[model samples]
Target: MAVTKPFDTILIANRGEIACRVIRSARALGFFTVTVYSEADAGAPHTLQADRAICIGPAEAKQSYLSIEAILNAARATGAQSRGLAVHPGYGFLSENEAFAQACADAGLVFIGPPASAIAAMGNKAAAKRRMIEAKVPCVPGYQGPSTDSGQSDAVLLHEAEKIGLPVMVKAAAGGGGRGMRLVRQHAELLPAIQSARSEAENAFGSPELILEKAVVDGRHVEIQVFADTHGNVIHLSERDCSVQRRHQKVIEEAPSPAVNADLRAKMGAAAVAAARAIGYVGAGTVEFLLDGNGHDFYFLEMNTRLQVEHPVTELITGLDLVALQIRVAAGDRLPLSQDDVQLSGHAIEVRLYAEAPHKGFLPQSGDLVLWRPPTGEGLRVDHGLHESGQVISPFYDPMIAKIIAHGATREEARRRLVVALERCVALGIETNRGFLVDLLRHDDFAAGRATTRFIPQHFETPAAPVADDTLLNIAALLWFERAAAACGHDPAASWSSTGRLGSPVLLQYGETKTKRLVAPSGGNRYRVQDQEIAILRRDGCRLRLQVDGQGRDIVFAFASDTLHLALGVRDFACRDITYQPPAEAEGAAERELRAPMNGKIVAVLAAEGERVSKGQRLVIMEAMKMQHEMVARVDAVVEKLPVKVGDQVATRQLLAALNPAAE
Candidate 1:
């Protein structure tokens, strides 16, 4: 029989989808969920979904989610209201923080995760590598000891790198989520790479220690979901394949890995179980490994002491509620099932929906979601912390908005289901990777389950803005004209406007290109757009049914002061009304300036004013949404102006520096 549930209530010490996800499991188990939020997350979906909630601190994470003192205090204060007895740092903020876990223990509250000691042991990538090696787990050959923070001489470090060979990975000892990692391919790039890695490491994880590993080229990233209890019982769920990535962050994940077979799964699972047993782990954790395509060799990567972002796929395949298991283990229960009792039934795939523009370097985006309609049907699940409208996607945190998961009896069915769901979902107003994800899901390699880590960068290019054909453009022009008439208190469906005389000429601009179309009334709500005759069969707010030149079509459109945004199924188009603007003029060459891509704080100024630099030399570094982006010189030039200093906050397109071209 199962033991009694540990706590009557739990405080979720985080925000966003994962917090809402934890709240759902807690409620299902007959427990009250106390949610803590920052100032920015007021009325957020997670906060409203909680049984009780309290404001912890300001908008910035340092004062809110990352503040151990604030979280503990909130847990205490809400304990009276909701009887909160535990704190669950769902996934991100302090999920693996050893001090936070110890603080929960000190405050006489259960921490729904591993012990503080286990966290400390596996939290450091280098130390975990050593422990796994001692436990007889296979690890990649690299240099880890005599950390960078020890002030080891550059010569000695370079010597170690030389031993590890070129093309090594410089990783932060206590970092995850792709921060503080650099791939150096040559000796000349070692020092700067190490310096940047250390700086990012110290800022992100409070550790400056570095580890070097041989870069595994074109490998599949697979991880096992392992669970443990206080009774010394540990078991491994199946594996997840997370090979598709960008900037070292996962974009897509699925399970069981297409590349992992039964024999390979057993070997990897046994190794993961041994690792957890050796560390005396408890609750939910993940053991990551890099597998070569040949299916012959697998090497241990780092272990995540807390639950992973890709845990949903594993949960789906195994038909288990991982969050509920975490709660039961924290309550000091024994293993619910042994290895023989465990089973995997279905296939599952999940894609991360991020508030980012894939066409523009995948830079993070933030704004209100004007139209948020995710797909709904059988075998599809959307885990999110967003309402239908009026939800703000904040820039002070990660850009990911939701996780879309699909499950099926087979991998092909699962893949096809996810594709259809992505095609049907619509998220508008600000930019997102929605279109790009659809393309990836339909790619041949991805569909065939043959993708590797280099699949995206090698096989895909940043998609250009969708090009509107002549017919589509004509329809858009008509819709714009009708919307303008309606806004000015004129009846859009009136016959006089179209039939009596020539209608107004509408000028529309898409990107930098503009086109003029002459609209005239043909007959009875029917009109001539450019050259094609069209009739309006039906009209609704932002939705219209049109028949163009003997063909029927449906269109969805929204118009603002000077722009029209429309969607036809999965494709979207943006066109501007340039009717009032003057004719285009012949212009000279554009100015050379370095502009910020997103709102962020200036982290470093790498070049001095008047300093001559070659093309592609690093000039500035900006930190936004907890990720760093480096700006480089596009041409051989001298730095003419440096308007922004370190620690300055900048908006999108704000100038950071100016350059005067140097003699070639």
Candidate 2:
């Protein structure tokens, strides 16, 4: 039976892509949209998309998105409550906070998610596992005890680990998403692993509670999307395989896993439904499991009581808008489809576009995005919060900037189309994993549907960055020449025969390597650099059409100061013009400087002034992009200066410590 509309205004109590996603669905359903933002996101896409936007607090999440009081105040100040409002807590910040859900209920506002009781039942891994065991769900064998901060001694955890055997997973009981997780394979590593995981958990999730599970090696990460309503209707919308990962975070996801057959899907789907029902779950949630390689046995991992980052792939395959369904269910409407009514269509694949350098251990990067152009196609969808070029990708949020999804009649077609779409994507000024995603999709293992959770580690463990070849160097030189000519009040596309036969020497640097080349104009729109001849056929903003040594090529490029950021095919290059600059300084003392890898807050400082440290010893630990990074000593040296302390926010390349060589 249809009920009265519960709300007319929907307030998105989150930021970034997810906020934008909810706004689209809420507005489509004729609901007035309200969004909240931090000071950093004053001009963000989500804020701009909403009919009304409010600034909750500063950039820090605790003071903004995670603050229940601030969100409530914003809702009240905007008169959302007077008009009947529902708060849509987009995934991540405060999405699964039971207290926040109860607070909304106490304030006579509808929380567009599972009930507070359900969230509490499933939020803690230890409690959830105990409950699932009682509900007869197959779970990995291990220990579920009190947290370290809650009087659970280390001895008890160690004893449990020994009983469960080696190679166990230490996980945060209060959170998911791979944060506060560690895999311990050796006896000597268990203690450190537990400590590290506990610390990270306390910081990321506000809880130090932990659980142990038998490490399921070489298993496939599969999750089932389940939805329920107040009318006692629950259905699973197929399965998604998120096996390809790094640092325990999913990189690629696809719906209708290749490993699961009809029978297996039914069984897994039933188990997922059971898990949700056991917790009295409502709205959208995901039941994750680790599927064995044999494609038969599966074990429950955890249940995410919120929409997942990879929801688009399921939406594409099932032809459903999960966000819209979430809104409908929150408004006292029964589910539109039953279990038998749900149909999975064509295969769909999605990849996260992160502002990170894959070659450098997937280190998150932050800077002004000089250019942002997502590819458009029939079967492709790009969900992002970036609206225009020159937007700052701040360090206060996750590094994932967008998600690209593709749908096709078959898995191979979907894979192929995703690769092409990724290749066509243009994100410059900041480093990204676009090229890596392309290569991963084309890998023989991935193409054959044999990728397991160990896909990235087994292969591409030390993936190298693409090197700048001689041809690329020549192109950079020519582009630099054209820009220089234009800056001097001359048409770069015109002939440059007036410069004479010797040509001008250009010094270009790619990374730490520099090369000097002689470039001269041969004729109109033609130039000779070294032994290669190039002709510029066309120029459209950053796009260049040229014939290099009789081979026609098209390149996408951008200029930031003296640096030229260009994408030649799938490879990206950032070349700096060092022409007419003195470069005779040698790096001696600079090598002893220990600097922050990215913008983050220092969590630990292990070294002090006047202390001598060995090479490769970890000196500091900082939290950036919701992950911890260690700054290590480069050489055996005496600490000359220790400038930073715990809780200090640091910028990239800022010195954390300075050292001097030890006396021989």
Candidate 3:
């Protein structure tokens, strides 16, 4: 292998963590880096990190990251047409778009990924399955017909689904990441599932094509990291088990699957390598499979012709810089290592930290990050795009804020390290699934390697809201009191008795519950709140050392106006101080209001203003963070006021519709 630099400058046509990740490796390899950002990401970390930054368009992905024309113009303006420039679409947006790849070639710019042909071959789930079948790759029994074509109707799908038996999977053919996917366990669900999946597919991937597969119940999701070069060398870096999933999206991924033995690894790796070779894949790609509970039987799920989100786990286990390899292969250099030279040294686990509330059906959350801290320690790696506190998490993109990875000598060690890292990680001011990730890693089924694709649905369905501990609330109340006292020019350390009276009672609201607590100073920085005694041992900005009921605890918190954001143990809470504000308004007036759950664009309005809807019927559908959420009628009602129509951008809690109850 020889050092070769095909392009002097590389433009990362992506944003956020993946863009930053690529910049790091490309800069280390001595290539000048350029990053493209949308209007929403003008001052983002990736834009700042790159040697040159270009603004493509607005906050919406279609006008910016996903717009190949905008991307090409940015490249050309940056001298891509004159000087040597390569574009790296990092794992999302237009990463797998064959048209984008071909456009780069047509413009005399190199695309730092697989060939356009390879992307097209694997971009469609139906087409890819057909090619894999031709290549002798084992596949799940299903119908791969073009469901969105004019001649092929829903009746054909229903017929084929019946032949495949009950419990089939309706999936979008044009994309992955669990979008446009539905599991149908009943006969009545098949048609609706097909329609919903098609609509989502058109929105997400610009295609309405779908495929049906026999649902491989209780199966493990295993994917092998495959790399190739122009010299025709291809090798696999082993498999990652992404069995811990929710809503068909991977939550936790680990390298060297516990269910795969040496022989099984060899078989899967061979299949993955064969799949890559069949498409003449260049650069990095992943071949995913659904491994049955028995572990020996496996079927091709799909091929992702881009760097995976869980590639860091593979990198940790193999001591390889995959991005660097991708750049090298795109530069026309042969692989530096052969299949025999590949090695896996340690076990690594990765978890995606999403800005979502798991208890609320994993609904994506958006707000200001008043405080953001990534844990640091040995064997821990935090990859994120957030620069600091006060960064607004816009709903224009994915809700995944960061990825935490840990590597250790063994699987147990890796699991423990990852759990500890997650516990120490702090992301405040917005609801997140952080605690959920910790609990999932510590679950007995996951620890004992018994988890499958059905693990979450089986054991953790209907996740409960985290119970607010009294002690934690007491600490929040005390902190609120001290801050208010300090703001009024009173000595926070002084006894409340010095003022000859107990201060105003603090009214804290968490979720929909409100509690009023009277705080009376008891000397020595101690405060009696309700019946609980809490003492502030030390306060350093947002960090606090406190003693509650003889138990010493350390907590991190932030105050944004009337709100107190704090992290206790692995959970984060945001409490609003409504003491001075007038309240007591009845909530019944707005009982029939259907509010938008988050900031998003209304993609579908299923009901008209005067239409009558039944309970549980979907009335409106909004697209946010690349996923669609349905707003259902809570009761059988007449849609009194449907203010929002399709294509309207809405804010969180913005009223989309109002209903009047129907006569019983």
Candidate 3 per-residue lDDT over residues 426-539, each given as its tens digit: 898788998999889999999998899999999889888988888778778887888888989987656566656475588888766888878888887887887887887887
Candidate 2's displacement at residue 178, Å, is 1.9
Question: Which run of 10 residues does model 2 get worst, by summed lDDT?
Answer: 582-591
lDDT, candidate 2, 1-664, per-residue tens:
3233468999999988999999999989999999999998999999999999999998888899989999999989878676689999989889999999999999989999999999999889999999999888889899987554444567888888999998899898887778899999999999999999989999977888889999988999999999999888889999999999998899999999989999999999999999998988889999999998777899998899999999999999988999999999999988998899988899999999999998888878876677889988979999999966878787888888899999999999999899999988999878899989998999999999999999999998987887788888888888898788888987764556566654888888776587988888877788899999999899898888989989999888889766788888888888877786655322443457877656778899998899989989988998877678888887889888899999887866688998887544
- How close is every model to the real structure, measured as TM-score? 0.86, 0.89, 0.89
> Would you list the C-alpha lDDT of every candidate in the order shown?
0.83, 0.88, 0.88
* Clash tally, candidates in order: 0, 0, 0
* RMSD of candidate 3 to true structure, Å: 4.7
List where candidate 3 sits over 4 angstroms from the true fold.
Answer: 1-5, 146-151, 498-504, 583-664
Distance from true position, residue 24, model 3, in Å?
0.6
Backbone clash total, candidate 3? 0
Model 2 lDDT at residue 35: 96
